[model samples]
Target chain A: MTGGAVADNPGRLYVNDKKAPESLRDLRKIEEALQGNLGRAREATVGIELGEGGAGSGVIVSEDGLVLTAAHVSGGVGDDLVIITADGERHDAISLGLVASTDAAMVRIKEGGPFPFVEIDADDTARLGDWVFSLGHSGGYDDARGVVVRLGRIVRVADVTIQSDCKLIGGDSGGPLFDMNGRLIGIHSRVGASLEQNMHVPIREFHRNWDKMLASEFIGEGPFAKKPEPAKAYLGVAAEAREEGGVEVTRVLEDTAAAEAGLETGDVILEIDGEEIEDMENFLEVLKGMEPGDKIELTVLRDGEDKTIEVELGER
Target chain B: MEKTRQSKSSWASARGLLTAAALGAMASVSPAQQLEGPYRLNGSAVLQAFEPLREVLQSSSAVLLDDWKSFAYGLVVSPDGYVLTKASELADRDEMAISIGASKFTDVEVLATDVEWDVALLKVDAENLTPVVWKDGEEVTIGSWVVSNGSTSRSRRRARVGIISANAREIKGSSNVVLGIVLKTEKDQIVVEDVKEDTGAAEAGLQSGDVIVEAEGKKMEKREDLLDLLGDKEPGDILKVRVDRDGEEMDFEVELMERHRVFDGPQSRNDAMSGRFSGRRENFPRVIQHDIMLSERSVGGPLLDLEGRCVGMNIARANRSETFAIPAAEVQAVLERLLEDSR
Candidate 1:
């Protein structure tokens, strides 16, 4: 895809500059820093393309080029792949593993690093209706240049992160979620009806499973000082304990539903059907409810480990 | 075998013809015309199959990542209602919907497909009647005129003509007799004179698969349009074959062999290992699996042989496109025993 920066519009982001009160100028500084950091963030964010499977959205969560995204965007992929970075640079990355229940994965870039990075704020309290921000990449190496920030309202205080009037798009999956203080709030998850409905995984969830995500290329930088609630099922979808540590993708069956969905062999699974998956038992039990040909999303850790990706649901 | 000489030397002529077709209609007096009048074709057929076929297809439905501007071949035979098509068509499924070519969308359920034979089955959600009839292993004679039906873009079907060049020839891969077809016109023709191994007009003392130099008696410009001319044919039908084999050009009175498929379900390299064979865990430390190419669509479908007899159900695709088919013959035996007990 041709890579470049897309201009900002109120409909696209949560914190509209015009809406930022003068008193919150310091907060706006974070946004400016984000824009500056994001320009360089190209090194961190990678554009993913799985042949036959549409291109997916991914972010550099680690300095080493470890990107993060929903697993459904990259898991169980069978098509050829091409990875592109900001500044229009293109590289190749492979998927590691996929936890069927949680639509998440891990991808790895083959070469070059030292990319612009986003630091996750382990202690920021994400309040309801806080103006959150998002940065995403898409087609053409130049297209992955801009960011989208939408006000994420804490709509549901339950097990799910249901925010109202928040928007994400086909190219926004797996991007970062930022708080008003410009701290990382969550990872962009998925889109629903209209631009107002969107889903995201709390950035804190990464801290919950830091060990697993750190198993590969990640050197933990987060000072996560809090613990999330214990796991439980939500809406018939199994919600397990936050991963003690994230899992790296070891194998992905080629041409299966997973492979066809564009999942490679090294992607790491992060979430499933909106539920967070932690271990093998939790993962397997979640899968029992779904039959073959079920489509879901997955978040994974790719090469250079910190990047996240979002893959569309395909066959298992 | 005969068209090679004509096409290799008649490239310009074919282009001229295609350009003309693209500009408007392909032709009328195209000797390959077999149908009576203008048959009205409606919207695409992607539904209408067994309940299971529908269930699987509905779940497995996906859209091609990119929309293809042209029409592709799709057929239905029902491996108990699951339709079969070429694997290349279903290789990359985006979501559960297929992009409509020429502004139309066809929601296709790709049940099973194989890379080797490039065959796959998809279940569409609509229903019944008017399925294309098959000519069950009909023996085709040499030198007969035939017709072909195909579409270059989605939604439109066209017909062409050619001839039968060869029949029942060995091509190496086990299974069926692969035949060859050829075509030749007046001034231009393309094709190779002859060769060995690969089936087509060559085995029939005709060296085809070559470029046609002259065709339809038109001025021989270069080779290429020959295949298009020849493809306009049907099995058991024959016409003149001007093939170019091994850089040589020749014209053969070739007979066209009809295409027949061995209703195979999903199959992997394990054709020899059809049934579930498990050994005692104590006897073997672990079960060794030979992963071969299989297709996801093969699930819940039947595998057939050259004789059209059902062999097994395609279970999985491994190592890319390799498939594994579970023998229906074995499943039938189990069913017999179960029925016997009920009696």
Candidate 2:
């Protein structure tokens, strides 16, 4: 890889030695680890059907069929559901305790005992870049299709959610996310526009509220808790286009980034982080890419003088 | 050998710092992480790990280009320029060129095509190209790690990693929403020329010579207006359809049915949220579904397993998360039949 045709292709970098599996031997070891746990993973995974045609997935954690699924998938407390196992057998079940804030919920199969189950990662040991796999009934379960499996690595682990590149879709919500060792680490909750924006409810959230959930209590604020829907960055300023050049700020909301940054109603925003703001529309286009808590430098014209102000955006 | 080993170890440690910096940027929490951007699994940093598998995989892969832009990727099946690609994607075979191993060949001939399998065989004016080594499909089980390789925007071959997401089985096409009516245009008026038997249109007593006046309260003046309304509707959806039969306005409730049961055509909607997918995605005899993100242009390339062995040729990009590949055994059978037919 040092000196070959790779050099001919400009703007390309091919480094053979790095963090990912560098050789065939390394890749095979990863493959073996995934294969060893696959059978157990499949047996414990189940498809969930909300009576009104909504579908999801869950994993059996206990021998008595205590299942962990997404709070949204669980719906209202005591809502009856049909649980379909990997073998295509359907069983009766009902929603149990739900933690709406973190999108964690529990369910119990009514009839059967000694059901197949996977172990949970009680230690919350999932680290960034740890190899993980997700299992669910993608596009809902088809007898011939069986349960679907997706492989990815932990990209980001927040307090309530874990993000991965294991591309998820509709009907995959509430599916089980497991480490290479088959330990349940998270449950699928929501998917964003891209392939990597898959968010899951970390198992630690379930563990923290396990006792409350087992008691069939709605833990997070109410039955329909406001789950963390990634918020956009807010500047908290109303701007009107001015014929001269930049837009003039008409109003500044109280306790917002703009007010905190000493922006007045008459101040004209000239630029954002050195980029010229043509008008209100251009300023909004720049703000669309910004995230909450992002600190930006705003150049404004006040009293015929330009001033630079630093502001930390707030969540909308 | 010792010097090379030392440099390799140093590069590994340097990359480790780069990986840490990226994670730190996300962990800071002040700046929201770009969730849509590349992550650990699909990022370019991860591609460095596939360098060892690149030479062999890239050499055997071929790309089909139209007007200097690649439209499909092909697998070199024989040393003497015998290649295979998705048949339906080649809309105009005469205008396409085959690019393999730094050589672009325009003197390409279509040998044979299997319509049901969507496989096509091509003969190019080149020789001694590396062909892909086949692996048994039985070895490809669910949850197994598989990698797909094809030409990137720079025309450089790159690989993406994923897992076998589902069982290797037949994907029935046309499981999509439909109105079950053969429409025709008569002087700017949308007319139902024929309604299929046992369909929602026929059940609602919609007959030929009926001019469709409105659907779901939206006025239908042309064939496109009715199509636009039907596009937004789903199967099992009951819509109020108003038609004029001999100047008499009457309303009937019509329920949409599956496309396969009503007609033989492509699926109705391409999930806009998932991005562009192959127009001819479904109805494969057998497919090994995986979650590797393959663009429509990247389809028809080689799908390799962890051991850097070819397990299949990517047949279609279904959606953002799903890509379908024809098994190696099945591909070989198609090649044999195509060769026989060409002879």
Candidate 1 overall lDDT versus native: 0.37
TM-score on alpha carbons, each prediction: 0.30, 0.67
Question: How would you encode candidate 2's per-residue C-alpha lDDT over A7-82 as one tens digit per residue?
Answer: 5433212222224655566666666777888899988999887643456789999887889988777774555788
Fraction of the real A/B interface contacts present in each candidate?
0.00, 0.30
In model 2, the runs with Cα more than 4 Å from the true position are A1-18, A222-316, B1-39, B92-94, B150-155, B174-270
Best by lDDT: 2
- The complex in candidate 2 yields a DockQ of 0.12
User: What is the i-RMS of every prediction?
Assistant: 30.7, 15.7
